[model samples]
Target: MVPVRDELFARLERFYDAIPRDGAHTEAFGGLVLFVRDGAGWPFYARPRLDATEPASAADVADVRRRQRELGLPEAFEWVHENNPELLAVARSAGLSVLEAPLMVLDPTALPSVTELSDVPVRLLDPAAPTFGADLAARRAVAAVGFAAPGTAVGGAGPAARDTALVELPLDALAEEQCRTESGHRISALAELPGQGAVASGMAMRVDDAAEIAGIATLPSARRRGLGAAITAALARRLLADGVDLVFLSAGSTEIARVYLRVGFRRVGTACIAEPA
Candidate 1:
């Protein structure tokens, strides 16, 4: 069933506005909100102020882009299509290409538990473990390759793929993106195959009752074997088990969304991501 549009969007609005408080600060430019990185953690992007009566204008988009240039940040913007459809047009008018991701929320009652793959159990990434450094580097590499390869289609890439990436995937790889400190706000999980290590990886970010499962990816060779969705399920199940009221994610494509659907996530909205042309 579709959720009440206003209620759902409002909940998401609060989730968006509150999430950056942990590692970034929000700056207002007319009807837009830019989450500026403060030297650490995740680098957030600009989003629409859905609660505002008037939609974001082209000038508002230009102003945010100017500030991003001044600060040396990626001139990126994101928002839910239903929140203010015009904002996507605004972003386009400002000449940024937009990606429409399938926004989904888990059906808690229908959520499934995926504990392992081919006997390799899924485990949360331990920052204090002996392999933490290698695992972090490997996870980053896998995600990089997985995203580069795109979609959930299985290929020949696996641990061999990640190991090759680990050759140069520095231990300080966390600096490139968000943190994985396993605190209240952020948590990461990984699954390992025999010989191959950390074949799949994902992270969950919490903001009060809401949690977003993101960066879920599988090694290219490991695709079609259910590893990506397994990692995604493990992360979502963990958050819901920990008392989060809503667990959601943005699927890169319908193929990926179908993988998530089998994990009990139902499409609720379209997450519009605006990036440089």
Candidate 2:
């Protein structure tokens, strides 16, 4: 059998390289491919191209960062360290803070026991569903609320906090979410309260047998209730059931990676994310 590490990075390069095609286009800078957004929406980052063997130069990283500043975009870069180990030094040399997150891959056969979350029902969002029109905005807004505070640590914030954030959630988020779904991804949302809409959500981006679970978040009010894990496991099971062989994600931190570990994902490598210093 091919090594899981090898299989993971090989598939990831292709997945990451191709993901920008939907709402963004790629601009080549040496061995790097910068995912530049076509218009207003969530901005993408730079990465080593699929065919990249040698590490991109520090000049390439600086050039990309300069281009980002010119375009009024964030100086962000993401890469699987094992796939292009030398890029880490290049990014640091460019005066960027590189956070090495746990690069995890799911073991399909060992997924956790998902007890029925009746109170906070989680389900995959379908563009074809009749109720999709009514559901899309709220679910997309939940992500903005969840990500604003970041992490699993809960506080007094909850439903009302989400309500305050709803007005600030841009229409661009909905458009971006739509673009991702149209690009062959499956989005899942969880509604912890009956009267309100979704409070936790995530998506699985798939191409052939490779899928990456991302944007998994639960509202500050709803944290520590296993909502993030539920959304993750739901998306993972959905992808595997549909024949995806490799499912992976990059955790925000080591503590957060433990949440995914409950759902049978193990760290296979490091996911390097670099941003402005």
Candidate 3:
């Protein structure tokens, strides 16, 4: 396992702070913190201060739960570091289920040389642009299909259900929220396949000095053709050019991790997402 650097972790902390949790509630107690973003449709866990001057206690866990109830969020929803077994135990004792994945980071010096695909055109979509609404809808459609494909993270959802949920998403509101804060910036892009509107799509968000690369998906018919890699590399390069140096993402699986590794990312630590059981 590549040791997680303190600076990288600090960046992660800031990135969390920079997220635009519009119309959300936040509470902090000792080593624990929680955010309830209604628009996000999920609650998020702030990095636990397990290593703070005072260790996390049962009181903190109780307080976090209390806040969750107040916000009407699910009984449990947290993003925690796997290294903190103490925190994980507390959440588990509270009846939360945990799913862990690798936290990967890209070091500028190790960026791989990814050749741009000439035949496939990849371009960034500006959220504020006039055509953003239609483009975003198309991108979300592609994402829903990608996520429902066999072997993907959100796989069990059949295409029809996935498409329905995605199509109903408030893309306009999401676009507005992504750009409302100075700390947040979202870049959406797509790879056009011959005769297909878009076969591959992804997005990256830069919050202050740190960035997260997410939603990289290629349609089933477009897999193994490097479209995913191309989109990821393009987004990363754009973020780097924009002056946000610390870039990271959570890989859903080892195969996906391998895809990211080709673009200079290395597994640094384990990231765990826990939700009500």
How much lDDT does each candidate structure score? Answer: 0.79, 0.78, 0.68
Candidate 2 matches the true fold with a TM-score of 0.89
Candidates sorted on lDDT, descending: 1, 2, 3
Displacement of the residue 125 alpha carbon in candidate 1, Å: 1.8
| Tens-place lDDT digits, model 1, residues 1-277 | 3356688888887887787766677888889989887764447899876456677899889999999999888998988887778887778888999999999988887777785422447787776676766676777778877887898677877776677776544334453333436456777778788777778888888888789999988888877777877888788878877889788899998888998888889999999999889
Give stretches of model 2 more than 4 Å off: 1-3, 116-119, 167-183
Q: Model 3 — which ten-residue stretch has the worst lDDT?
A: 150-159
* Per-residue lDDT over 1-277 for candidate 3, one digit per residue giving the tens place of the 0 to 100 score: 2235776666675565556355466667777667666565435654464346665666777777777677676655445373465767777777777767778888777664446433577878865676666677667877777866733333333334434545543765664634642234878888886555676788887776678888888777667777777788888888888897778888877778888877778888777777677
Q: Candidate 2, residue 171: CA error in Å?
A: 8.0
Q: How many times do residue backbones clash in model 1?
A: 1
The clash numbers for all candidates, in the given order, read: 1, 0, 0
Q: What TM-scores do the predictions have? A: 0.89, 0.89, 0.79
Give a tens-digit lDDT track for model 2, residues 39-130.
77669999887766666999888889889999889999999899888989888888999999998888877786456422466777776676
Leading candidate by lDDT: 1
TM-score of 3: 0.79
User: Against the hidden true structure, what lDDT does model 1 obtain?
Assistant: 0.79
lDDT of model 1, residue 192: 82
Model 1 misplaced stretches (Cα beyond 4 Å): 1-5, 50-53, 115-119, 167-182
